[model samples]
Target chain A: MTEQETIGFFKCLADKSRLAILKSLMEEDMYVERLAERLGITSATVSFHLKKLEEAGAVTSRKDQYYTMYSINKPLFGVRIIDILGEKTSESEAQKEREKAYREKVIASFFEYGRLKSIPTQRKKERIVLEEIAKAFQAGREYTEREVNIIIADYHDDFCTIRRDMISEGIMTRERSIYRKAERNGGDPEPAGR
Target chain B: MKNRIEEFENYMRSSAEEKKQKIAEMVRDGRADEARAVRAGLNMYEVMTALFGAALKKTGEGEEGFSREFHILKDNVTGNWKRNLEAAEKHGDAEKVMIEESKLETVEEIVRKFDSLF
Candidate 1:
């Protein structure tokens, strides 16, 4: 099979239904109606899957009066599969360099390794407060402000200052002795997700 | 079912072998540079992704799927830069050259890995 067709085979197998349909058809040729029924899916879905397989040359179809018969295309299939599962072949060097650079950038950002805190001026007291709140919530059921403050101090010496900064930033609120995340503490009858 | 999966495996091997052969042919015909370039560009991840995408795009045998590379991902560096840098910025992201993430695998490696998983 040509490189283009081989690529197509990989693409076709990307879907579960397509894979199942292809698997089913490996047994024998079947019409759209038959395939849909056997797979417990709609005829439209059947048609869609068949179309992809057909274009990939994984299968072929022909007219049969009101029914359209579909079956696997064995020869092209063999070659395409062999190419994907076989030996190593390198891509263009120029392309590789360009792609590799892009990939590294992605990794660096993810494994930030203190790079995130590289910005010197700490304009974000919000993040600090968020960290405290997040940790407190690690209590799982969520807790009051007193508990959050205690936890913060447990983790940090400047816990009081952080708490004050957070309060000024409208992050947390003191309701009686309980500390709660300002947003989720008391919203409407409907939450944001709803 | 087992036989069909086996057949699929064989097809995958043959296709990859075919690609290697074709690249070898290019090198044999004195197009060494181009052949090397071609070899470097493909990996199992890319091949399977392309194949799966192609399959989905075919007449009615696949579903819509996209590879990792195909999806539009925000450049967080650029996003953060835009958020932070107040100075007269001369450049935006997507234009900037950046290093990619990790040690990439070849197509054969991807298939072997995938086969083991399945």
Candidate 2:
């Protein structure tokens, strides 16, 4: 079964009324009224559940005389749950694109002409801002502490907080008062002309 | 009779496949409604469990309150089946039957109880 069908099947099973209807049908093929009688629910309600069950591929109906008889759809139930749940589609990629757009929007709102207006209080917004600042440093090149401060101070007055946050968020790394953009930031750490 | 069952089965399989493909396309296009539909299906179990838990908590009033409430709710639900059967027998209008408000309220109460728990 596909994810949608799997979900529908499980959802059909979750209801007490539907379960009762299925249980009654399991013993013998029954029309709507007979099922209503057996299950002690109204025919309308039985029909309601039957419609859902039918959509879920859990039951099949047949016209017999003036009444329609319903029976279990055995093949549908035979499907593996893992197969249903394990299916992955492009929805995840779409979700990633949405998140990326939101990040860009946040950066645009908080920064003016390569300078940050203020430090964002929210961690997620702050991370985006820090990443924007990280772009000022070249990959693989080490800068003295003073050089790092000068670069960061140009973006924001509070160079100390921004600088420290960059280290904490893994946007940059510091060693022996020297700093370089993290490799994960896609910076080329090795300078040209080795 | 046998032929009809076989035909229905074939129809069901093909229709299910078609629906699956349609849903896949919807997901690829990032249709929010498709996501909501899938999520709604997945949430059924959670809703059912919450209802049952809330019902049990509500009926925990006395020594036999839990059991009594459970049976009452079961009967109320199952009783609808019987009532529908009876209505069909009398009026031949089984499809027009309605579930009682009391029973629906019980479910609503269960939902409220679940919300409180969270």
Candidate 3:
């Protein structure tokens, strides 16, 4: 199943009434009123849950005479949870876009004319600012402590705090008095000289 | 047996048709008020705002306390609303299923009432 289908399937199972209906259906294919009677819920409530189950692909129904008979969808029940949760789809792309936009927003909020206004208290926001400052240093080249201070000071007056934050956030690495930008691949910072 | 996903898609498509047919029958039979009430009940913003307002009032928070409470409430209610809206939009064209203007106006009126409290 796709992400949306997986979510729908899990959401369908989350409700007590729906679970009861499914349990009843598992025993025998029954009509809505019969299921409602067995579960001791109102027929209307049973119908509501059945519709949700149908939408989630958890239940199937067929028209028999004047009544619609409902039954458990065994194949859907057999679908592994790992398969449902592990499937990648467009939703993942959409989520990535949202994260990118949020990162941009945080960077925009904290930076003014390529300078950070203040260190963000939130770790996530601070990481974005530190990464932006990290761009001033070359990935493979080392800088003296003084050079690091000058580069970070250009962005914010509190160079020591910014430099320390960079090191703490893993955006940059410091060894002795030397500093270098950490190599980042897919947002994971790799320690320098390692 | 039908493919589960395809079965669901078909079921939703047919359900929408059935709803439209029900509404058409209601109109033809001169029960527009009942239909309108049902439609209004289905309006997410109206339903959410009403529930939020009730919960807010239940807190008994005065103006001094309302802002902090409102922020907490807004996060949860808006998050759920956006998720529901996104899911609905994904399944069908949102524009086609858009709520009527008068109903929206009513929702706005309800929100304005809450705004007055803060």
Residue B66, model 1: lDDT of 24
TM-score of 2: 0.32
Give the TM-score, chain B only, in order for the candidates. Answer: 0.36, 0.31, 0.40
Model 2 misplaced regions, further than 4 Å: A1-89, A188-194, B1-118
DockQ of each: 0.02, 0.09, 0.03
Error of 2 at B5 (Å): 91
In model 3, the Cα lDDT at residue A84 comes to 69
Error of 3 at B109 (Å): 38
- Candidate 1 docks with a DockQ of 0.02
Best by DockQ: 2
Residues A1-194 of candidate 3 have per-residue lDDT tens digits of 65545766887687666777888888989997898778775454466667778978999989999999998999989878777667667877768766866887887688754668799999888887777777667778889989999988888899999888888878888888888778781244431111
Per-residue lDDT over A66-165 for candidate 2, one digit per residue giving the tens place of the 0 to 100 score: 9898999877777677766676757876577568668767976887545688999999999988887887788899999899999989888999999999
Worst 10 residues of 1 chain A by lDDT: A111-120
lDDT of 1 by residue, A25-74 (tens): 88998997888799885554466567667877889888888887998887
